[model samples]
Target chain A: MITFYEDALCENCYAVRLLLHMLAVPYTSHFIELYPSRANLQPRFRAINPLAELPVIDDDGVIIAGAAPILVYLAAKHAPGTWYATDTPALAQVTHFLTLAERLSATVGAARRHESGFAPTDLPAAHTGATRLLRGLDAHLWFAEQQGNAWLLPTPHPTIADLACFPHVILCEEGGISRQPYPALRRWCDRVKRLPNFLVMPGVFLTAPPKTE
Target chain B: MPDPTTANLWHPIAACADTPVGTPQRTTLLDTPITYTLHGEGHATAASSSMLPVLIRYGYIWTSLGTPTADLFDIPEYAEPDRRRFNAASVSVHVSAPRAVENFLDMSHFPFVHTGILGAEPHTEVKEYDVETSAERDEVLATRCRFFQPQPSTAADQGAEVEYVYRVPHPNCAILYKSSVIDETRRDVIGIFVQPVSQERVRAHMLVCVLDDRSDDETIKRFQQTVFGQDKPILENQFPKRLPLDPRAESPVRADRVSIAYRRWLSAKGITYGVIPAA
Candidate 1:
């Protein structure tokens, strides 16, 4: 069992939540308030994650902070072959996109925070950076699809990279970054949503399942 | 005859690649809220407050707010087996459609607006180009234009002289055919489809069809995306959101011949949707 520290509105927490649900792993969520009154800053939560950042996961005695790290740790321990690949090349690609996901949190996620009054940010710069990243990601996915790869990495199966990038990119519109410009990314989001056991948080919705002939 | 500006034009609202199966995409065209969805047999249907005519062409979903007087613009290169096509992300600017169209028509901004990549500071000269109205097609054509670019396309790693031909088939559509880095005999075609959200905002959809097989779709998209990304800030920061039709409203130089012709054409067609009429 995993103790998942998360916020319903935080995209970072949502990333880890998505992975946990998809893996069908039993976990109890400790909901934290991010704004108005920062409950994560409370002494009790800070004892769990000194950084006061979400979403940290306590796997029995072992605790992990941040969404990417939690995703990597959980996938490696539980759903290895499926959610997380053991191969070095696939792992490297996953790590690369995980870093990109963090960047998205800072930019796209930051813009959303600014718009929703959760945090203060340079709105224009955040939006510009987010747009640039979206364009690049869209192009990458476009070529990936052209080569018959559905997810971010070249693997036949969806990996942590898809999960890591999914939430922020899908919910970027709340931050004034429209995903309409990125068709490939949007399609990739739909693919992620269609995965079995996929769950949605607030501001995220399920896409219709793919049709069968 | 129906109003050419309002009735006869097809505006690209979204890219086919962006509009996937089972989801509805919403956008505003001419201040009208539009909802588009892909249905059975891969048909794209668009609806607003009322019925809208929708057509999918060259990897884009085009719709008209009013009755379309003509079919979507023809691109023979779309059928060419040797060419590769890319649909870049749509860029939204806080400027009117006419201003956006005029910016697309102007080449002088390449050095200042798109410096280093599209042009250089030293090569600011705009050589003479010929612009005329193609009566048969009812389009404005600008030909024999040439410019130097540091990196013309993703396939080009070095600077090269690029030949250009600008075509405006509709009030809100502009296409540029420029020399390809891979094959000099074959030119790359880029179409800028502008959607007027309101009097002060527009979205530009870019379609690139090139004869080069060297680069992948991602590379082509990134190159175009970078170029347009550089242009967005300048377009958004421009003084007047709506383009002024009067020649005296803004100073025109030799390099603005295509822009002048476009303005004249828009004025003649009475496209007041996103234009500031002459005082």
Candidate 2:
């Protein structure tokens, strides 16, 4: 059992929520308001994380903050060798993409918050940065598809890295970032949506199932 | 008059292996789109509005948007019998060429950006290094920099302290020579050649020449690709797509000596194709 601190519209929280559903882990939710009264600044939430960030998890008293770290911990503890590999080099490669996912939270996630009136930021810079990230991700996925590797890492399984990055990229349209130009990324997003126990947030929708011949 | 920055420098447009015989490859250099085909006799013909010189070297197709004053810089290691050269796939980035070149010259981001592989959080400090511009070769060089890597190369089985030297021979090309794990005396040379597709776009071609016999060609190429894949998002999302030329534009620390020298060199050369003019 886990206690997930989440918000429906928060991209980071969406990643955590998605992972929990995919792993079929039972968890209770603590809904936190991101705006209009600022519930995250409350004393109860501040006790959890000094920074008061979203997507925190309390896995039976093992409290973890931040979306990336919490996802890593969950995958490591709950679904090891499945959602996360235990090998050193494979873990290192997953860490690389996890770091990249944090970058996406800063750039693409920031842009979405600004566009949706949830936060204030340098909008133009955020948009530019988000576009750049999307372009690189598109290229990477294109090559990965070419090499017959479907996930972010070169394995047959989807790791926490893919779950960490998927939320913001799929919801980027709300921030005025389009997925039309990235054919490979769009296809990859569909593949992720088709994963077992996948859940959808407000801005993200279920991808159409592939047609059978 | 043609812009001297675009006219007098050679930019690598595509990999030789990517441009097979009789197949036309299309790419952009300095904002001009051109299509060229390689023939059976080792000659290339281009169909464009203007004529441009082309050269094939180091497994890359080099072209100029204007008249070039000098040939491409030489890497003597290419002739060494023990060295193996690899031409990795080109990465298309949405940042200016100067920005990409500057990022390649920077090593401080290894820990915070690249993380576990290139560096770890506890070993984040970058020791002081030496930076100088060679008058003879007209290139920016940085030496004596060192960092601890969990996996220095694809073939490495353990962590090692890697010595590094960086060179910026052209406004858009940066090369790195790092100590090799397999060979105690020899080092690995990697070149990043950025082609300025437009004012705010670039395509980076990476060439790895190493003396390691431990890893196969596919392994080497995949490792390089994975490393570069880690850098792509960071490079693209950097604010101010065009690099700022002013020393005061962005704050710099001791670890940024290479980036400072490279920016200063670009400013001194009067290159403005992909740079924000000093305010």
- TM-score winner: 2
Global local distance difference test of model 1: 0.81
Q: How high is the CA lDDT of each candidate model?
A: 0.81, 0.81
Clash pairs for candidate 2 = B7-B66
Cα deviation of B273, candidate 2, in Å = 0.6
Locate the minimum summed-lDDT window of 10 residues in model 2 chain A. Answer: A30-39
Give the DockQ-based CAPRI class for model 1: incorrect
Each candidate's clash count: 2, 1
What residue runs in model 2 are displaced by over 4 Å at the alpha carbon?
Answer: A1-213
The pairs that clash in candidate 1 are A183-B18, B8-B69
Mind giving the per-residue lDDT tens digits that candidate 1 earns over B55-162? Answer: 888887788877777788788887888888757547666788878888888888888767677898898888999999876898999999999998888788899889
> TM-score of each candidate?
0.60, 0.61
lDDT, candidate 1, at B117 = 77
